[model samples]
Target: MDPQNYPSMDQYNYSNNGGNNNNSGYRNQAPQQHQQQQPQQGGGYPPQYNQGYQPQQQQQQYNPNQQYSPEQQGIGMQQRGGSGNEFLISSISSNPLAQVGFSYGQSLFNDGKQYVDSNIGKYFSFSSLKSYFNVNTSYVFNKIKLIIFPFPQKTWKRRIYRVGDVDSYLPPRDDINAPDLYIPLMAFVTYYLLYGFQLGMGREFSPDKLGTAISKGIVGWLIEIGIFRLGSFFSNSYSIPIYDMIAYSGYKYVLMVITIISSILTGGYISFFVKIYLVACLGVFILKTLRVVMVSDNSANSHHDMHQQHEGSAMRNYFVFGVAMLQCVILFFFN
Candidate 1:
């Protein structure tokens, strides 16, 4: 082998060292190239980290002048409005005046409900009175005819029904002889309207006048109720229900309405003779209707002593006559 062609020991060691240095340089350059390529791939960060960080930058740099669609604006407005409403409700709940008003209204409602349930509810059994309004068209037509001419109805006694060993009168729907408040209330309203109409025809109609007429009619009705109650008390007769008495007394209003209607049709004024004839019809109706209430049943009278029954019967007849006579005065006043 030739030593000069290969190299001396010193030169050989230098060449070996240069070779190791060049290999290390290539290894170091490989890592530097990978680090440089990282920036081009994903901005020198992990993909997930970049993804998270970009959203934050976008939020911070968001445009304030961006316009939204109507639906989006509405949704945003509703959210704000809902918050505002909550704030307003809180403010109202804390206000003393609002609290006071609420409490006052609640108290008034409770008091009114209690008053109606206590005083008025006791006398008026609304459940039972519902039957009065159960009348059909035929019943109403026949009832009007009977009221105008009651002398033809031979049967004045109200139908009796037995229920669990107790006897109860049939409702007006089932029996024509039964008393009802529906006709009376309707007739009373009709009379008022007729009266108002008459006044208008005469060029004397006024709200105050109409109000006064209604008040007078109501007062008259109450007076009749008082008379009937007193008579029942004094005569020691078989007392009917107070509502029945109200119904009986209210029948006069039907006649009064008819009379006023006749007057309006004839000459727009009630004549004295026409008033007298109506009074006679109303008196006869009242007398016949009250016979069922004022007179004691034989079965009921059997419970009383002879003297007591006889005395009661005599007083009842007197009271009934007096009540019938009162119709003339009431009819005349209405006219």
Candidate 2:
């Protein structure tokens, strides 16, 4: 009966029944009470956690895509003040200076037109004239032969000499005399050089003299072109182009060069005689060439009626003579 039976006080305290099971139930209930108190003090539940996070996400999404209203744009423009308003006005308004300049130009153009109209015929306009300078080597050789020797038979055979020949060789058909600038250009340069040489020898080789010579050459060329244009207009045939006439006119420079060389070498009337002879031959050549080339359908009929054609032929010869006389005059004056 000793200490072995001494559990009496503990058994009375609940060790004899289900005391251990009750203690375990109290532990579980204590944790549930703590969990219930946690939610009342800002601790998030699973559903409430997403509710706060959702608003933050919405703010971030809208921030990047937001646009300023028109009212905001107006506020920005007003902030720039007068400079912005000036730029806008300048962009919309037309310039007064530009309008004045246009009116001035129109008045000047009208004045020029009036002056041109007042002196139309005397004012010889060459606005529509064109020139080509490509002469064939064979044609050039023939031209030289005709000018130097004045041999009628051989020269006539070599070039277009008759109305029928013109029909065979003129434009719409290619011929030996298909306008070339080579001989004409070479001749012009040679003439210019010879002229300078002559001036140098004459002790009149100032810059002003050289300029005068060049201007004279240019004026002479223009006058020659004008003369030919007039001839074509009056002859009633615009068959030959301005370039061909220019080529023909430039050919005279070749003779001029030769005469100058002869004058420099021989220093006598020999040069003068040669010039006279060449000028005469050139006139005859032009007469014959232009007569055939400028032929019309009525020209052949005129041949049958010589009385009717005589006046036309005479006029053509006179025009050729005038061109030849002009050449002689230029030679005398310039050389």
Candidate 3:
């Protein structure tokens, strides 16, 4: 190698130190130069870099104590605009199939409501029947006692409400003597359950037999209603409401439930005699209660004239007796 091609060691070190000093000087001056050019560039960035850049002057100017108006908030929300969810909802609402489905569902609901209002609504007023369910535990206990042994109660007449020329019978909640559907409904349900339980105890439980039992119960109930309606018609007492008749007819289920329970507890041995006694009690109860309803005037009348013209007529008594005696047939049929 030629000696002149490479420098001496001391000269090489001096050249390297000079290059390092230049690089260090340039690095030290860069920040100062950048600081000096910031005001000219308007935001510490070059003109080319700041083509669309904006400083967050609003954030810098914000004051925590400032109160914003609803108008300002609404404007901000408008600027933010609708999200993906809003767009999807709008799309669905604009769809022809979705619109058609919505219209069809609304029409179906309306048609069903109209049909129900036109058909069964006229015959049954649920609002009036709400009073029948207002019974409490105490009322239920007393009612059960009355059903079992109604002879102790001397007053079978329902309490009358006379306020501002409006005459009506007090609800069962207010008057113990008043007819209610609650006990009857509960007893009816309990009778079926007890009958099923009795079948279960005997290992003879079947859904078919249970259904048969329910059918029999319903038939018996309908028959009783028919008997009452016919008896009222024949006896010349047609002032009673059909709802009242229904409540009255339903009460026999209470005695039926008792008979079933007695049968269950006694293993079907003493049940026959117990059923006879309960049937008799139920018959007496029906006789007395129906007699009062048959005689009392449902329309406007003074206390003296509350009794109808045929209060103690033979036909009325005979009808009442016949209704009472028919309960035995129904009870045995249930068994």
Q: Each candidate's lDDT (Cα)?
A: 0.81, 0.65, 0.80
Q: Which residue pairs in candidate 2 have backbone atoms (N, alpha carbon, C) closer than 3 angstroms, thus clashing?
A: 133-180, 133-181, 134-179, 134-180, 134-181, 135-180
Q: Tell me the number of clashing residue pairs for each predicted model.
A: 0, 6, 0
lDDT of 3 by residue, 46-136 (tens): 6777768767765557778999899887986765566656888999999999999999999999999888878977756667788878788
For model 2, the local distance difference test gives 0.65
Give the runs in model 1 whose Cα sits over 4 Å from its true position: 1-40, 44-127, 268-273, 296-298
Best by lDDT: 1
Per-residue CA lDDT of model 2 for 147-196, tens digit only, reads 55554533232133358445433321124434445666787888878878
lDDT by residue (62-163, candidate 1, tens digit) is 788987889886997899999999999999999999999999999999999889879988866677878777787777788888888887889888888999
The better-scoring model by lDDT among 1 and 2 is: 1
lDDT of 2 at 322: 69
Q: Which ten residues in a row have the lowest lDDT in candidate 1?
A: 52-61
lDDT of 2 at 17: 60
Better of 2 and 3 by lDDT: 3
